[model samples]
Structures are given as C-alpha cells and as structure tokens.
Target: MSDWEDEAEEPSAGKQRPRAPASTPWMPPQSHKQRSYREEGGDQPPTRERAWEPRGQREGDRGGFRRPEERSWSSRELPRQPETVTGGGWSRDFRRQEANRELASAPLCFRLDSSVVGTVIGRGGSKIRELEESSGSRIKITKGDYDSEVKIFGSSEQQDKAKTMIDDLLERYDERPETDTRFGYKEIRPSRSADMSTTVTAPVKRGINWASLRENREKYEIMKWADLPPMEKNFYKEASNIASMSQDEVTRWRKDNNNIICDDLKEGQKRPIPNPIRNFRDAFDHFPEIMSTIKKVGFDRPTPIQSQAWPIVLQGIDLIGIAQTGTGKTLAYLLPGFIHLDLQPLPKNERLGPGMLVLAPTRELALQVKAECSKYTYKGFKSICIYGGGDRKGQINVVTKGVDIVIATPGRLNDLQMNNFINLKSITYLVLDEADRMLDMGFEPQIMKILIDIRPDRQTIMTSATWPDGVRRLAKSYLKDPLMVYVGTLDLAAVNTVEQRVFIIPEEEKRAFTLHFIDSLKPKDKVLIFVGKKIIVDDLASDFSLQGIAVQSLHGNREQCDREQALDDFKKGIVRILVATDLASRGLDVHDITHVFNFDFPRNIEEYVHRIGRTGRAGRTGESVTLVTRKDWKVASELISILERANQEVPEELFEMAERYKHFKIKKDSERDMIPRQGRWRDNP
Candidate 1:
C-alpha cells in the first residue's frame, strides 16, 4: 500500500498524472493494469489511457478530446452484410436455432411436496441413484421452500418408467404405516387419497332367465325345516337329543373329547348344541343300511366330529366342521349329504342336475371323497370325480350322463359350469372339503364363480383342519347362520395321537438323517416323508430307490395317472415310504402310515400340523421326526409353541435358535431405521 501511494503521488520522468473529473460517473477500477505494469517492471509507472475517446479524435486529434454528443451518429459505417440478409434477420435465425436446441434438450419436470423428498432420495441419495440406474435417466431434485421440482433428463420411455416407479413406491409407502422404535414414533396418518372412493358396478349377463332362476330358488326354499314331514321331524328331534347330557355333563364331555363349539347365535335364539352319539344306534337307528355300512367298516361308535355334526347337519342346518385330518370329516359330511340327497323335495327326474356337490381342493381329495361315496353306497346313487390334469372329455361325458353326486376341484368344476357341461342349480347339498387348503391354492375366485350358479337355499357344509381368516371370511360370506364344530382348539394343532420329535441339524445332514431313519424302520412301518420343494421330492425318492427302498414320490408336476398310482401304492403298502411335497399334506388318507418324517420343515406351521397328521389315523398312535436348520428360524418359535401346546417336548436348541433370530431381526430393524426417511407427503407426486 505504501509503494502504491508513492507511485500515485509522484509522476514518472516524462509523464504527468491525470486527475479524475468531478462529474464523471464512477467506473470500476482496473487492478489488472497495475498488475501488468508491475509484472513488466516495478520501476516504471503505468500509462493513463482514456478508453471512452472517440475514434476520430484518437489518432488525428490526440491533444484534445471531443464530447460524445459532438460526434455524428452515422459517421461510422456498419459492417457489410450478405445480399439475402436483412436487418436483424441473422439475429432472429440464431435465436430460433437456439430455441429449437433448447426444446430438444429440455428435461422432464414434475413437482413433489418437500416433506417426502428425503424418502424419495433415501439415505445419501441411494434410492434416487437406484432409480436413475434402473430407468436410464438423470434425476435432479431442485428443492424449493415448500416443494421440489424433479427434473428427469432422459428419453420419453425412461422418464415414464421412472415416474411409474416413483408413484408405485410412494403408493406402497402410504399403504403401510411407518414406525420408528428408537423414537417411539409412528406415522399413523391416512393416505392422501384415503377419502376418495371408487364404485364399480358389474353389468348383468344377457341370455340368462332371471325370472325362472328366481322361481326355482323360491321353490327350493319352500322345502325348509317347517316343511319337513312329521315323521322326519320326529326323527331329527330324537337324533339331536338321543344322547342328551346335563350342562355340566356336556361341558365335561366336550372337554374330554377336546371339542370346541362356536355357534353364532344370540343367547335367546340359541339352541342346545347336540351331544355325541353313544353308539351307531344313537343317530342312525332308523337307517339300517347306514348301520350295516358302519358295522362292515368296523364297530366304531363315532368320531367326535361325526358324532356332533350328524345331528346339526341332519336338522337341515349349515355346519362348519373344523377337525384334524383323518378325523372322519369326510364321513360326517358324506352321510348327511346322502340323506339330504335322498330327501330332496324334487324327485331325481324333476331335478336339473346332481343332488349333491362336493368341492375338494385337490384331485386326490376329490377322488378319495368319491371313493368314500362308493364305500358307503346310498340308494345305488352314481357319483363322478372331476379335476384338472384329468381327461376333460371323460369328465364332460360323465357329467352329461345322469349322476347323483359330483365331487370336483373348483377349477375343473368352474370350467364345466362355464361351458354348460354341468348344472349347479339342482345341487341341494353342498360340501366344501378342505376349505382352508382350497383358499391357500387361490381357488376363491373360481369357488365364488361356481357358487354363484348354485341355489342360495341349498344346505352348505364346509370342513377344514385349520380355521384361517380366509376360510372364516368364506364361511361368513356363503354360510347362513352356521354352527361351528371344532374337534380341538382353533389354534393349529397336530393330532395328539402323533408323537412329535424335532432335531436341529445342518441342511447338508438331512439326507443322512433320513437314510438313518429309514434304516431304523420296522418291516411293517409305513412312513410319509415331506419335503419343501418338488425337485427335492424327486431327488430324495430316487436316492431312496437307489438304496433299494421301495419309495413312491408324489408332487404337483407328476401326471394325474402317476400321482394316483403313487398314492394307491402307498395306501396298499406296495411302497412303505411315500416322499411328497405339501400337495399330499391334506386330503391324503393312508390309515397304515406309522410315521411322518419331515426331511425338510414346511414353510408354514399349518402345513407342519397337516404333515404330522398324515401319520396318526383312526386312533392309531404314530411318530413324527422333523429336521430343523438355522434357515428355518423364522418358523422356529411357532414350531416350539405348537410342540408345547401338543404337550410334546420342545428341544433346547430350537429355543436358542429362535432367540438368536429374534436378536438378529432386532439389530437389522435398528440398522434399517438408521437410514434417512422424510415425513409424509401432502400430495402424491
């Protein structure tokens, strides 16, 4: 600063310092000139040059300066232009080209609320980067005070895909509440579109006789309980109270039999739930042929389910029977169905279709029910079993011909009904067997479609081993004031007759353990080995075959004939060991199965119960050995609870494994919570 002041105060040898005009406008000082002069040589001073001097005065009149107004406006000639160019034409053309370029390169823009920006961006912009990579777009979020504009630079397709992804993400986020355990905070707000309602109306189908259908339904309802003959009414009343017990006696009886009854009726409207039949004569004293069939099968009084279900079903009431597999559920429904079919108000000739319709979840179950119908012959009635993977033409042939009973899987039955090959209007007795399994297989839509054609006044009987929410919903939707007869607690429990044992082992050791178990089996011992995957069923079956063990494999991938043959062989003891997937978990009835080996634990606890139930049947004690690994820790706690409820020993390792998994899950959730997340969006993007 001292040197600069010295230089400014004193002039150089041949130069004089010029003073700034008092009225001159302030101009920004150029330090670059000083820097250049100093860079050249600090000893010499910089030259003072006036940049605003007119061109005419610059060279010819350097001694004096002229004012800007004195100079002529048109004194300087403009640069030459081409012949085709006009005033500002080139400028206009340049601007037009620039505008077109900008239009072509413009990015896609959208707006989102400020709060949800962090959620979209994720921790450290991970979610945005993922979107960009997946969509082949460059996303830039320019945040404002209240909102943000998302600019996506990509082709039209990429931009559209990115937008769809973001929309889907936000939609999913809005559907489930967000919770942070660390702060004990939860976002319980409703979605932005929660207030919006969408109403959809289904159009009526043409070419259907609405009036005739209504008339038929009215005629069917005319045969209700009040319309039954006096003699038949007396028989129902006697059968219901034949084994009557005191309130205390009834409670003790239910507890001893492990029966849980849930009748959906008000206290004033409730009727006394029937007690169990003491013997075959208690309920079927009037039906000698049924008594003969029961005697020929064996001297068995009646299973708890059959005992209680017969009276309620016989009284023309809807029944929901929940019992373990192999608890004579089929007989409970079949006998009532036979009686209902025989007692139809409309005679066989007057009826449009079969008198009874049995909906099974699987082909095997359908066939088994058909076999049961065959076993207990009632009035020489003809029955047909139809399912997918079977001969469709043959099924249609059987349906076209007169049949009294129709047992079918929902898919095939729906197909037949849709094609007008089967008529459900005349079905007076309906039975939905294995209702839980059917729902599990996603047959609800088909079941609904099939049920639509059946008369609403028909008697409905639904049987299931487990009472899941889906089955409950189905029952509520279809059944009218049904009485629930559960053999045990509604919670999933295996047959108490089966002894459950679990072994915690590595996945690789499963095959060895199975082989060892097979070696230990007695000559008469029949076992069913359950695996998780279809390929594993084949692999294990082939491995057992290589070991010279007669094993039959059953899975969904097999042909219908092959599956039937395998099940038949297993039942007849041709193959003592049956290896299968969960396909055989339900509806597989083999009375002689002495053991159930779970080579691989099932994916769910319900399947596990069904798998073990395959072994113990008809009061015969059996055993089940399951192999558990670390990967199955998700179901470990549930397995322990099932074991404890059944009074079976829970292994110490299972408890430890469940505890470790719980800790791991907690740590994972905590780490996931550490990620950045924003507040709810005011409006969707």
Candidate 2:
C-alpha cells in the first residue's frame, strides 16, 4: 500500500509515487481513501513496518503507509554541480553523471609519463581546463603523488571521447620539449636518532669551521686576476700583455722573454710548433679524398688561432690560445685534436679511450663543435657530442664504444660521470674554448671536477677573447706554465672590420624603438638583439611575432629545440631579428649579421664587445646600435672606458650625460661632506 512496499508496483503513466513521510510518526495517514481503494483492489497489506514506529501509528495505519524511521530527504539540500561545463553544452550535473558512468565502463586507465606535473598544470590549470572543455568530457588528475596517472572520466561515449582527447593530449605532450624538471635529491641533515628513519643525514663536521673552509677553498680558488697574490699577479699581467700583444708583438716577446715557458719551444724557442701537417701533406694535402673533404668544408686558409694552436696541439704542447669568437676557435682546437689522433693509434687498453675532451657552455655549442670536428675526422677518427636535450642513452652508448673526440657541456658531462659512463683518464687533449664564458655561467667548479678526473699531464688549451679574472684563475690552476697565446683585449679597433654606433633613447620607449629598428632590418642583413634578461627576450619575441615580424628568440629559458630553431632561422635569414639574452652573444658565429642592437646593455663591458662583435665578423663591414638611456649612464660610462681604450668614439650624448652625472655626483658628495675623486669625467669623457 506504500510506495516503499510497492517495489513491484506497475508503472501508471509516469505518475509520481506517493510514499510515507521520511520520519516516523505516531499515527498512519488520516486520508485513507487512496490507500483503501488499493486495499479493495486486493493489494496485500504491508508485511513490515519501521522499527521506531509508535503503537498509535500502527493502529492508525489501517494498513496505510507510515513515515519511515530513516532521516528525512526533503530537508537535505541537493548537491551543487561543478562550475565547469563540457564542450557539448552538457550541464555540470549531467557531466558529473556522465563522468561517473564513463569511469564505471572504462576498460583500462591510460598513463602519461612526466617528471613535471605542476608545470603541465600551468597557472590556474588553464591547460587541462582548456583540454577538458574542448573534449566534451571530464579529465581529472589524481592526487599529487607525482605518479604519472591521469583519470579520464565521462559516460561510455564520453569516455571514448575523453580517451581520444587524452591520447591526442599525450601525443602533444610527447611532442612538447622535455623540461629539465630535476629538483635534485633533497638535502637532509644527518641525524643520529634511530627513530628518525626519514632523514638521510651525513655528518660533515670538520676540525676547522668557516675559517678553515675559506682557507682551503682559497687554496684551489680560481679568482679574477685582481684577487691573485702579488707573486701570482705578474703571471696574469704577462698573460694579458701576451694576449694584447699582436702577432708581431708576440714574436718579439717570445724572442726577448726567457722567464715565460713556451709549451713547444721551451725557454728559448723562437717559432710556434712546426707544422706536423706539412710533413703528412701526401696523406692529407695531395690525397684526393682528404683534399676534397677539406675543400668541401671550406678550409681555404688557416686562421691565426688555427695556425698557432694546430701545430702546438699536434706537437703535443699544452698550449693556451686566447682568441675571439668566429676566428676559427673550434678548428684551433679541433684540428689539433684531429692531428693528435691522426698521428697515433688508440692504445689497446680500454681505459686508454677517447683522446680529446672539448667542453663548451651550451648544447648547441657542443653540437656545433662536434660538427666541426666531424669534417676532419675522416681517417677512423670518430667524435660524438655528449650533450643534454637529446637521447642520453645514445650518447652513453657512443662513449662506451669509445670516441676520438668528445665535445660536451659541463652538466651533461657531470651527468655522464654520475652514471659512470664517462672515462676521462684517456683524454689526451683537453680544450676549453670560450673559457671566459664557461666560467661566467658557473661551470668552473664542474669543469674543475672534470679536469681533476682526467689525466693532469694531458694537453690543456684555455681560449677566450678577454681573459676575465675567473678565467685567469681557472687557467692558472688547471693549465701548467702553458703557452699563453693571447690576442689581447679584442676592441673594435683590434677588430677594424666591425663598425659601431649608438642611439640615445629613453628607457620607456625601448620596445617601440626596437620595433622601429627591426622594421629597418633589410633582407640580407641578419640582426641580433641583445637583452639583459631572459623574460624580456621572450616578451619582445612574442611582441615582434604578433606584429607579423618573422623574428625568433634565443635565451637560456627556451627549450633546446626552440633555441636551435631560432639559431637556424637566423642562420637561414628567414628571421631577420633574433631576440636573445647575453648567453647567445658569446661563442655564436653568425657571419652574415649586419646589425646588432643592444635592446638592453650588457651587465659587463666585455659582453658588449661580444654582442656587437657578432656583427662585422669574418672581416665583413657591419653596424651595431646601442640604445643608451639616462638610467644606463653608469654602464655606459664603463663601456666608454673600453671604447676609449679601443679608440672607438663614445656617443656625444653619452659623454654629456657622463659629465652631467659627474656634476650631480660631485654635488651630492659635497653636500655629504665627502671629497669626490678629481678629474673623473674630465679624465675619461
């Protein structure tokens, strides 16, 4: 007689079923017409009643339905649907039901592997949210266990839709550049407590504390030249002088100076290492195969660095050759590496493995260096680049097989070392090209570790444009009293080929000013824009692209693929303006660059030289424009010193601002009763 008792009741139209109240009552329904009619129709009386029902309620029942003892449903509020809507215009309630149904029916859960989940989620989970909306299904990632599993829930049809969506997403995810998401092992303090099992603490106490650490650290410390001791001071001064001294100056210095040690000639040698390649002219020069390979790669004439470094490297002299970028630095070391390998066969011992170790700061540079090595590696000389951003297992396998030359970045090399894949004991020639930049990027410590791992007696070549303090210290520590062949502070005057200029603009108008400059970039003129920050590189790149400018950006933040593409695009002249950070300014040789713009001035004076040096390269006439704003006057002043030393004229506006700031500085100094240095602006400006 009751709806609860009518479980087997037949449906009449789609009419609502009448039932007892949710709560228990003392009496049954007062209106018995409807129920008595059902009783007259021979419906059986209720066989069971709620246990909490009162006696009066049972008597008043007259076989009518009584309220149940269970909690009432009418007072309870219905659940609110999720705010998110599906792509197919399904309401949140319908979507939730559909998701539940899908989860119930789904045959198997698909998994996606990623070390980074939070990054994939992005801000506000917009990426996943967008995917859900477009797929007409609900996709829910499980709780953050760092597990790769993601749940796709919807109805069977919606589940199928979600699966397809998920599959497509996985494909895109796989196609996306792999991010370096390694947070590394957590640092845990060593604990003696047996109960503290979670902590993996190691006791690192030493007899000496801060002072000892400082003293020991300084023992092997590679500081800038200025921080070196008085006795070690002259070594760098001599090195700087050697670097600055021209080829003729070097010839004179080596002739007169006996205290300096020449790696090849010893104390009294007059000439660079004798050309070993000349003796094997029949093997390399006259031989049609080697000749063709050389010709095809465009080795018409040897560069100064190449000419000097090759013979010494070939002769097995531990020479340190300092040279500017694009001056054949790769070949300076690569040819030596090749010649060294060419002269001798690999030892039978497996430990006597790779003969060459060339370290660069970037994967692109590593790969590029390896590419150069490949050109001359025809005679069973195999070289491989062990760099990140690619398949590491393949590189590991190559290392296992042994290579003639191994070019790699510090981090990947460190990784290889951690995995026990790299054996540097056999490396005979260690070349650190772009040494200064390598030191600048905090690679010195890892590089030192790598050097220490290798045979110390191995030939070491540390090459750079201007030897910074860090580089000098690294050279002093790692390199023996090595042949320090420096090409001196490579100023614009030293490189007469590059023409430079400056444009004074306010700080606020930089983007617009950059846009105007980009518009002026002609088709054959490759342009590189240097920014101080990585984010600005991205922002300007995006802004330029949105304005229909086919520009590419290169920075440390970009994926390796993106960075490569930007470089390729610039190389191909498809993208005229390359927005980049200071990282790209060094060790990158794009000869066709006609314009270099300092979208932001460099942090140091040396970087400005390199950034502008990218243009007017390989003896081509080029232009560099630096937008000097009022705020950048301090940097501008430092830059002017280098320019002045190089005989390049500083902009008149910069000079005037330097003078004005000098007056203001003097005024402030006087107001504070501090005596300012005399002839400051006048001395320079």
Q: Write the per-residue lDDT of candidate 1 for residues 1-685, one digit (tens) a residue.
A: 2234445667673333445699998653424344335545564332232234544655565555455442332232223322121111111122333323322334555555556666644645667877877987656675666555566555667767876787666766575553221111121222223321221212222367999999998776665434332222112545555555677877777677766565653235876676666567877888888888888989557888887888888888788999988889999988877777776656767666787899998888898898999999988889999899999999899889889999999988889999999888777788999887777778889999998777677788899888877667766777877788888888888899999999999988888988999999999999999999999999988888887889899999999999999998999989899999988988888888999999988888888988999878888899999999889999988898899989999999999999999999988877766665576332321
Query: What TM-score should be assigned to candidate 2?
Result: 0.57
TM-score for each predicted model, relative to the true structure: 0.65, 0.57
RMSD to the true structure for each prediction, in A, is: 21.3, 19.9
Q: Write the per-residue lDDT of candidate 2 for residues 1-685, one digit (tens) a residue.
A: 3332344365654444455687966443422333444644645434432233434555556554455554322222234544442222222445354445433433223333334345444434566666666765566553334344444554456656755654454446456543322121122322223222342322222254888888877665443223321210110011232234455655554444211223432456545433212122322342345556667776566555554455455545567766665676776666545555554444434334677788988776787787677767556777888877867888888888877778898989988987778777667678887777888778877887787667555677777666676566556777765665545433322355666677888899988888777777666778888998988888888887888888888888778778888898888878788888887877677778888888887777778877877877666777878888887776666766766765677788888878888888877766665434563332322
RMSD of 2: 19.9
Model 1 local distance difference test score: 0.75
Q: Lowest summed lDDT over 10 consecutive residues: which window, candidate 2?
A: 229-238
**Relative to the true structure, how large is the alpha-carbon lDDT of every model?**
0.75, 0.62
Clashing pairs in 2: 26-57, 98-154, 98-155, 99-154, 102-154, 190-201, 224-469, 243-486, 243-488, 244-488
